[model samples]
Target: MFFKWVMLSLLLSRSLASQQEEDVGFTYNGFRGVNMSLDGIAQITESGLLLLVSTTWAQVGHAFYPQPLHFMNSSRGNALSFSTTFVFAMFSELTTVGGPGIALVISPAKEFPGALPSSFLGLFNMATIGKPSNHLIGVELDTLQNEEFNDINGNHVGIDINDLKSVEAVPASYFSDQENRRIDLNLFGGQPMQLWVEYDGIEKQLNVTLAPINVPKPTIPLLSLKIDLSRYMVDPMFVGFSSSTSALDVSQYVLGWSFRMNGQAKDLSLSQLPKLPRRGTKTKPNFLKIGFPVFGASLVLMLVFIIQFIVRRRIKYAEVLEDWELEYGPHRFKYKDLYIATKGFNEKELLGIGGFGKVYRGMLPNSKEEVAVKRVSHDSRQGMREFIAEIISIGKLQHRSIVKLLGYCRRKGELLLVYDFMPNGSLDKFLFDHLSTTIKTKLSWNHRFQIIKSVASALLYLHEEWEQVVVHRDVKSSNVMLDKELNGRLGDFGLARLYDHGGDPKSTHVVGTFGYLAPELSRTGKASPCVDVFAFGVFLLEVACGRRPIEAGASEECHVLVEWVISSWSRGEILETVDPKLEMNYEVEEMELVLKLGLLCSQYIPTARPYMRQVVRYLDREIPLPELPSLSKSISLPSEMSTCGDISMWSPYYLGSTMSTSSSVADSLLSGGR
Candidate 1:
C-alpha cells in the first residue's frame, strides 16, 4: 500500500511537469472561423477551405495556428512527441506544370519578414538562407526540383532543417495497405491527398506518410529521418503551412487539418471536408471509354500512320529531341508550349527586335505566367547537345539582381530561350531617351546610385559567389533591365563566358559590343574577369555621364567618354560631367565616388583593375576608396582626351573581330548568342 502511494505520486508529478499546451490538442473539419493567422496570399475561402496560395505569380502564403504549441517538455527542455495530419489538394491550369509546393513547418515565429517567394516558400530570403539563425524544422511537399537545394525530382517529400535543403528525402509515395506494395503519388495531381507527420522524441525519429484521400494510413512512411528536434525547437513553437509560387500559377488548398501535442492527431473527417474546385479546363476525355476496338487492325494501323505523317510534316512540332537530352526533360520546354505561349510568333507580341533575334512577350500556357521569349536562329555546326546543356546549366543561377533564365526550347530551325519578363524594360531607354524628351520618367539620382550598386552586386555574384566564374563580355547599360519596382536587374548572359574558379578562359574570337571590349582582347583573344571589369567601368560612365562610349564627331576627332570624364576630373570639375537630367539632385560625394571607381575599372592595363569583390565592397561602403595619388596610378588615364572613342587612339590596334551587341556563334564555337 505504501509502494502504491509512492508510484501514484510520481505519475502525478510527471503530469504536472508537462505544460498546459502540451496536454491540449485541436481538430478542424473545416476552417470557417478557426483561430488561424494568415499572411501574404493565404486566406479562408467562403466554402471553409484553407486556401494557402492562389493563381498568383511569384507569391508566398503562410497559415499558422493562432497560438504557439508546447513543443518541448517544460521541465526537461527536451522535444516531446507530436502528430499532425492534413488533407491538401494542389492543381494548376495546365496538366503537369505546378507551383513549387508547400511545407508543414514549426517555426519560432509566425511571420518571416523579407522572405523570398518561389522556391524559398516564404521561409527565408537570399540573405537569410542557409543561416543557423533560422530555427525551424519542417516536412516539405516539394513538386519542383531545385538543383540549388539538391532536390532529387519534381515530386518528393523531405525533412527540412534550418534550410530548404533536406536532410533526407524520398520520392513521394506510400506503401499501399491493400496491395502491400509501394505506389507513387503526385502532390500537384489536383486530387485531394492526405499527409501524416509524426515525431517520436524518445527515439529521435521523424516520419511522413502520404496517401489518396480515402486510403488508410500506410504502415510504412514515405520518408523517415532520424533527427533530434530539441536542437532546433524551443518550448513553444508555431505550426503552419507555408507555400509559394514561381512564375507558374497554381492553387494550394487545405480541405481539413488536425494537430496534437504528445499524442496521436485526430483523423480528419474526409466526408465533411470542403470540395476542391475543378481544375484544367474540361476533364480530358479518356478515349478508352469511347471503344474503337471494333475497327479492323489494318484500318486502325493505317489511320495511325497517316496521323503521325501529318504531325511529322508540321514543322512546329519537329523538335530536335536527342537521347542525350532525355535527362534534361525537367528543364526543357515543349516546342508546342512555347509556340502557343508566343501566339505563333505574332508581331503584336514583339517586345524587342535585337540583332540576335526577335524577343516576344508571352503568357505561358496553363500557368498564365508572363515571360520574354527570344528566338535565335539555330547553328547546325555547333553540337546541339552541348549547346542545350550549357544553356540549361546557366538556368540554374539564382540571384535577386540577375534576370532569371527560366528554360529553353529547340525546334526545327531555331532555339527559343525563355526569361522572366521585366515590365520596366531596359535601363538605357530611361537614361538616354529621357534626356531629349519632356517625359518626366527620368530616373532620380537616388535610383541611379542604387542601380549602380545593384549591377555591381550581380557582377560580384557572377565573379566570386557562384560555383563558376562568369565573365559577362558585354556589360553595357543596354543589357541592364529594370523591374516593376524600379530595381535594377542585370540581364543578357548570352555574351557571357564561364570558367572554373582559378582557371583561365579559353581564347576565343572577340565577341561583345564594340566600345565595351577590353584593349587586351585585341592582342590576345582571351576572355577574363578583368575583361568584364573593363566593360563594367564603361557601363558606370555611360550611366552617370549620359553619353555613348564612342560618339561620331563632325571631324576626324570622336568623343571618348572615359577620356571626357577623366579630363573633367583632372580639371577639378568632375561634377560637371554628371548627367544634367539628374537636375543636380545628387550627393556630391557619391557622384565623385562613382566617377572615380569607373575610371579605376577601365584602366588600360589588365593588372590595374580591381576584382569584382573589391568593387562591391567599395560600392557598399564597406571599405574606403583609395586616395587619388595611388588611384590615379592604377587608373592610368590617357595622356590626352581622344577625339574618338575607338581604340584607334592606340595605333595598329585591330578590332576586326568585334561583333555587334548580339554576337552569333556561327563562325566561332565560343561566339555567345541568344
Candidate 2:
C-alpha cells in the first residue's frame, strides 16, 4: 500500500511538472560554451563538460549557471522546485585505487572560496571540513571510501545537507524488475552513469534515481527524503556540479546536463545527448603536452639538489665541530639504530625520568650490550646545549668512579645520550624506598660508606686531578648511579663546565637542584668547585640520615637536614640524627666524623667548605681530621649572598671571565680567579 502511494505521488509530480510549460524559469540541454562559472580545472568541451582534468595528482572542478536561480520570490509561488539529469564518467590512466567523486550542489555563491580538493569534494578544508557552510546542499556520487567521513564503500551515493558527512546514503545501484543491480562504475574504469534528481516544493521532498546508460529509468527512486530547502538555501543560488580527486587520482567528466526550475522545463532525452569524447583525443594546452617531460626533469633536479644539500650539511656539521670534539672518545650512534635498540621507546623499557628527559633500557644489536638511553625533551631550553657540554666534558675522561658515556645520537628534534646500564639504578631509590616490602637488595651502611668515598674520588678527579677543573653544577643523589656491585659512579654532566687551571669558569645561569644549591651561588649566579662541594655535603647528610635534604613534615628547626643535624649536634644528640634503619650497627666514631665533615662542608660561607681532595683523604683515613669551628662560630656570607637576585642583571662574565696568573691559589680554586 505504501509503495503504491509513493508511485502515485511521483507520477502526479511528473505530470504536474510537464503540464506547467508556461511557468518555466530556466533550461539547459548541455554545457557547451554556456554562460557558466568554473572553479579549479573545469572546462566546456565540444562534446559536453569536463569537470576534472586527468593529468593532475589531485584536482577539483566546479561548474555553475552564470546567473543565480531565483528561489525566494518566484512568479509561480514563494516555494520553488528543480529537476536535473546528468551523465558523468570517471577515468584514470594508473591501475590503482581511484576516485573521490562528484556532487550536484546548490550553493549561495558561484565560487566556493575555501573549498578543498580530494575527499572533501571541493567543499571544505581543515578549518570547516566537517561544518556546514554557504547554505549548501548536495546529492553526491561518492566513489571512494573515506573512513573519516564514514563512507559505505568505494561506490555509493549520499545526500549531504551542508557538510561533507552524508545525512542519508546507499550503495550506487538501481532496482530492475524487483531486483537491485549494483552500478559497475569506477572513476578510473571509464564507466559512464546517469542520475536524475528532483525536488517537490509543496511536499518538500527530494527524489534521486539512478541507472546504467542502456537501462531504462527504474520505477522506484534509489533514495527519497522529505527535506525543506527553504531553511538551507537563499534567494539567489548556483546550481552546478562539483567533483574532486585525491592522491589516488581519477578524472570526472559530465558529458551532458539538463536543469529546469519552477517545475516547468521539458524532460531531457538521454539517447539524443552527444557522446563523451574519446580518451587521448581531448584537446590540451600546448604547454601541458610537454608538461610530463618538464615535470620529470624538475623531479630529477629536485632529487639532485636534495642530495647535494644533505652532503653539504654533513660536511658543514663536521667542520663546525671543535678540534676537541673530533678527538672525543665516545662513538656517535645513528638515531635509527638506537631507536630500534630501545624497542621504539616503549614504556615497558623505561628506566627512570629526570628534569630534562626519560631514560630507557636498551641493548646494542651487535654487541648485545645493555645500555641506558636518555631521550631529552625537545622543548627543553638547555637540553641541546647541555648535550654538547656533556660530550665535551666527559667524552674522553675515563675513571672507575665516573660513569662512561658510550655514545650519542641526534635526529631532527630528538637528542639521545647512551651510557652503560646501571643495574642497581640511582642512589635516591635506595635512600627513599623505605616503605616497599618487595624483595630487593638494600644498601648497607658499608655500601653507603663506599659510595660516599667513590663519589668523593670522582669529584676529586673532576676538580683537580684532570687537566681541567670541571664544575658539576648538579650533584644530587639521583645523579649518582649504582653499579651491579653497588659501586658508586657519578654521571649526568649536562650542567658540568670546564676551565683551565688558571682560567675563570664564567657562569651566567644559576642552575642546580633546589635543596643542593650553594647559598653563595643563589646571590651571585656564579658556579665554582665549591658549589660541587656544597651539593656533595647535602648528599652526604642525606646518605647518613636516609632522609631528604628538605622535608615538609619535619619540625621548624629540622626542616633542612643540615639545620637538623647541627641542632642535634648542639644538643649533644648527634648520634640520634643517624638513620634508624642502620640499627646501631655502624661504627659510632666514623659516623660522627662523616656527619661533622658534612656540616663543615655545607657552611654558609663558601670558603669554609673543605675541598673535595681533603674530603676524600678524610674518608680514606689518609689524613687526620682538622679542627672544625663550632656551628655558632662559623663565618656567615654577606647579606647580598643570601638569595639569587634579579637574574636578568646577572652578568655573563660569571660564566667565562678571564683570570690573571697572579691571583691567589684559593681564589683560583674557588672562583676560577688566577
Candidate 3:
C-alpha cells in the first residue's frame, strides 16, 4: 500500500518541489516527492523512508537538498534567520552503543571530499577540521563517547564550527513544561525523535530543541549558544545530513524534514510521514528473507551461524577500523600491514618483553625498512582515540639523541607502537651483562662517559629545548636504547609527559621503575623536570659505579649506591666506587666529577638538584662544578622500592599528552574554539 503511494508521489516530485516552497521553505512530509541528493548507503526505500546507512562497519553517508539554499543576504553580508526540523531514528541490532553520530551540516558545497568516518562523523577529517576555508557548521547529535572530542557522555548534542571538536555541548535533554523538569533523550534508542534547529541573525543566537515525535516542541532548547553564524556562513550554502557508523553496528533514517530561510519552517505532517520499516522486513529482499529460513530449516545455515558466533567470541575484540587507524602515510599503520610485516608476530621475530608489553622486529614490505613494534595492552576502551592522537603528536619529535616514533597500529584489540629499530638493543646489556659470552669485553669508560653525556643532551632537549617540557617519568639504563653508532638515544616514552614551559606542572600518579623514583615524587605525586633530574642522577651513579640504586642487601643497606658513593668521597677514595669492569682505565678527573655531580643531583631536597641544562654544562666543562651541599645532608632515597604500574597502560584522560594539548579526555580537543 505504502510502496504504491510512494511510487505515485515519485512521479510528481519535480512539480511538487516548486509547489512545496510556498512559505519561503520546502517541506518533505514523507520524502516521496523529496528532491534530495543521496550518497553512500543512503537511499529512498520503496516504503518512502529515507534510510541513511545500513549495518556496514566503517562507512559514511550523506543526504542533501538538491539545490543550494540562500543562508545569508547578499547586500547586507549578514546571516539571515533560518529554521529547520527533522524526524530521525537510529537502530543498532547487535550492540548497545549505537553510532559515532549524525550531524546537520551547513557546508559551502554539497560534497565533503576528504571527510573521514567513525569519530569524525563524516563531516571532517583530522587535517580539515579546523581550517577556516572549510566554512562549515555542524550540529551533532552524537551517540558515542569519543575521548578525542571531550564529549560529556555517549548521548549528547554539540555545536561544531569548522572543527570536529565542539564549540559548546551538553548532555541530550530538553526542558518539559508539563513535567516542569528536564527530560533526557536517548539518540540511539531506535525510536523516532523530532529536533528543531534555529538561528537568529540579530541576536547571534543558535538554539536546538528535541522531543519525542508524538510530543510538542520543547519550551526550552536542549542546547543554546550565542554565536555569529555569519563567520561560518556564505550567501549560497547547502544544508544536509551526515552520518558514520562506528564500532557499533547501527542504521539511521530520516522520516520527514522541513526548512525555511527567512521565516518559521513549515510543520511536518505526522500522518503523512513515512513509516519506519522493521529490521530485515521491507529493507531486505523478499528472496533473501526466505532463503535464510530455508537454509536454517535444513540445519546447514544454522551450523554456519553457530561456527561464526564461536569464532567471533574466541577473538574477544573486534577489529574496528580505529583499531588499525585510517589515516594514510607515515603516521599510522594498518593492522594487516603490520601483521604481515611481523609474520603474524612470530616468536622467532620477538625482540624483547618489557613491563608494558612485547616487542617484535619486523620489515616493511614497501620500504624494506626494519622496525620495532611494541604491543601495549590498555584497559580502557574510551581513551583509544586520545591515545592514538598522542602517538601522532609525539611522533613529530626529531632529534639525533631521541629515537624516532614512527607510528602505531591496532589489531584484535592489541595496541602496537612502532619505533626506529635499534640494532645494539639497550645500554643495560653492555653495562650490566658484561659476564655474558656475547659481551666478553666491557664498555670502555670513555664510551660510558660519552653515553652519559649523550643521554644528558637528550634529557636537556626534552626538558628545555623542545616545544614543550617533557618529563621522562621513567629513566634508567634499560630505556637508553643504543643505535647502530652505539650512541645513547633515549627511547621509551610510555610514561613521559608533555607540559607547557611556564605552566604549573600537573600532579600524576607516582609512576616509574622501582629505584629511579625521586624522594619528593612518591609523596607529592607531581611530575616535573626536577624529578627527571633526580632519575638522571641515579642513572649517573648506576653507570659509574656498575650497580643499581637499590640492591639485594640488608634492610639498612637498601640504598647502598648513594651511601657507598658518599662514604668513598668522604674517605678521599671516591675512585673506589668506579666500575671494576673498566679496570681503572678511565679519566680520574671526569670520573670524580661524575660521582660528585651525581651526589649533588640526588640531594633530598628537589630544589638542590641541578637542572638538565646545568647537568649538560657540567659534563661539557662549560662551567665548574659547584661545591657539594654536604655529604651528611642525606641523598634522596625511597624507604621502600617497588615498581609502579606502567602508566602508558592507563586512562582516556587522567592520562597525559604533549604540550599545548589537554592531557586528559575531559578537554582533549585540539587548541581551537568551534
Candidate 4:
C-alpha cells in the first residue's frame, strides 16, 4: 500500500509539472465569436466562465496554438491578457509561426470582486532589445535619441509616434549603426538569434544569453538588453523593444505576456487557455471562382476548328467536280456502251480516216442499225471548242446537200460523232482508184454538169441562206458526201466559220490543204468565203480534167490538169479542156459558163472574185457571164495552205496507186461534190 502511494504521488507530480507550462490565462470581452470543431472553447456570461483550449501543438520542440482565438460575443469593449510568466515563457521559446519575443502590459480592472485580490488586466507586445552604451546594468529609456522627420534627400525615414506615452523602459541603442551588429534574418545564414523585453514594473533588470541550449551557462554580447523603471506603469500600456532605426528583421516572433502574482507560477496548459475568434468580412476572393469562362473558351475553339474543317472539305469537293466536267461533259459515253454499239470498234466494220481522229462503222444499241462513228483522238490538235462546234453546227444545220448528223458522245476525254453511214465511201477513192467502177459507170457528162451546179447551189446557201452565214473555210471535194443517187451532201465542219449579215468575212490564218488555199492568203492573212471559192475552183477542175491537185510524176506537168484548163480556156480551146470521158453527154454552153465562173472565183485578188451567189446565177442561166480577161499567166497552187475544218473517211481496203495519169486509172475513181 505504501509502495502504491509513492507511485501515485510520482504520477500526480508529473501531471502538475506539465500543467505549469501555460499558467497564464486570459478573459475575452467583445463582439466576436468562436465556433470550434470540437467542444474545445468557452462562452463568456455574467455569472461565470469556463476555459477550453487546444493541444494540437503542445510538445516543447514545435508547439502551435491552433485556433479560434477570439474575444467573447459581447458588445462591451473587450480586453485579454496573459496572466503568468509560464505563459510568457511560451512566447520566449521557439515556435513554427515564429517566436521568442514576449512582454507584459497590465491595467487595473474597473470592477473587482470584494472577496478577491484585485489585479490589473491588459495586453502585451513581444519584441527584442539590447543594453545601453553607458554600461548600465538594465534597460535605459531616457538615452534614446529622438529626431524630427525630414525629406531633404527624398529618402524614406521612420514615422514619429510623439503623442504616444512611453509606459515601459525602452532598451538602449537597439537600433545600432554598427554593420557587425546587423541581423540578416535569412533562413540559410547566421541570424541575430536572441530575445529581450521592456518591463512595465518599477524593477528594471535584464539578463540575456547568446545560445540558450544550456541555461546554467551564459554567453557574452552577440546582443544584450536593459530597462529603465522611471516611466513604468500600472495601466494598460505597451512594453516592447525599440530601435533608433528600422533594421531589425527576425525569422520567428510572438507577442504575449506571462502572468505573475507575489512571484508565484500557475498551471496554464493549452487545455486551460481561453479561446479567441475572428470577425467576418463582406467581400469574397476573386481567384477561387472560374467555371463558366473556361467552358466558354473551350466551346469557341471547337467551333472554329469545325468551321475550318468544313470549309476545306467543301473546297476540295468543288475542285473534283470541276475536273470531272472538263474531262467528260462534252462527249458523254460509257466504254461498255460504245463497245457494244460498234461491235468493239472492229476492223471489218472500218469506214475511213478523218482529219480530227478515226471513223468506224457501227450500229446503235437496241436497234442493230448501221452507223458511221467518228472518234476524236485525245491528243488531236483540236480541243473541246472544236468538238462542240462540230456537234452543234452539224446537228442543227439543214440542207439537202449537208450530211446528216445523228448524235455525238464525249467520254473520258474522247469525243465521238455518229452519222448516217454512206456505203459508197469517199470521193478521193473513186477519183484516184483504178479498180473503182463508180466513176466511169456513175458520173456521166450530164451528171458532171449537174454535180457542178449542185455544188454551186450549196455554196450559195452556206454563204447566204442560214441565220448564221456559214463559211466552209475548207471546201475540198472529199468534204462533199455523195449518195448512190449522185446527190451532193456537204459534210465536215471542223473548220467552218460563222458570219452574221452585214459582218465582214474576216481573213484568218491560212488553214486548208495546199493547192486549194487562196492566192491572197499570204498577203492578207485572212480566210473568207473567197477562200472556199478557191477550193471550189480546184474542185471544178478535178471534175472536169479527172486529176489530183498535186499528182506524183507530173512535175512541171504534174500540175497538168490545172495548167491545161487555164491554158485551154484562155486560147478558146473549150473542148480540149473538158473531160474526155464526157463525150457528148454534157452541153458546151453550160461547160463554158462554169469554166468562166470557176476562173473568176479563182482570181488572184479576192475582190476580183465572184461570190457563190453569182456563180449559182451564172450556172442556172439567171445571169450573164462578164467579159473575160486573157489568162496570160499560169495559176500555180500555193505550196503551203491551211487545212479545211471538215472531216471525212475513205475505205482503206480500196487503196490505189498514185494518180498521175487519167489513162492509167479510169476517171470513175473520183466523184465528190463539196
In order of appearance, the predictions have TM-scores of: 0.49, 0.47, 0.48, 0.43
Question: What is residue 131's positional error in candidate 4, in angstroms?
Answer: 99
- Model 1, residue 76: what's the lDDT? 75
lDDT by residue for model 2 (516-620), tens: 877676457678888898888888888999888866456656666876776576567888999988888798878887887777666556665667887887798
Q: For candidate 1, lDDT tens digit of each residue in 355-411?
A: 345689898998999999988656545566766776777788899999998988877
- Model 2 clash pairs are 506-654, 506-655, 506-656, 507-654, 507-655, 522-644, 663-674
- TM-score computed on alpha carbons, candidate 3: 0.48
Q: Which residue runs of candidate 1 sit more than 4 Å off their true CA positions?
A: 1-21, 280-674
Native-to-model Cα distance after best TM-score fit, residue 585 in candidate 3, in Å: 0.6
lDDT of 4 by residue, 577-603 (tens): 666556657777877776655655554
lDDT, candidate 3, 326-433, per-residue tens: 663568686666777889888899887664567899998788899998886553365667667667767878788888889876664457788999988888888878
> Stretches of candidate 3 above 4 Å error?
1-329, 553-559, 631-674
Give the top-scoring candidate (lDDT): 1
Give the number of colliding residue pairs in candidate 1. 2
Off by over 4 Å in 2: 1-330, 378-390, 437-439, 631-674
Worst 10 residues of 3 by lDDT: 646-655
Worst 10 residues of 1 by lDDT: 665-674
Q: How far out, in Å, is residue 298 in model 2?
A: 22
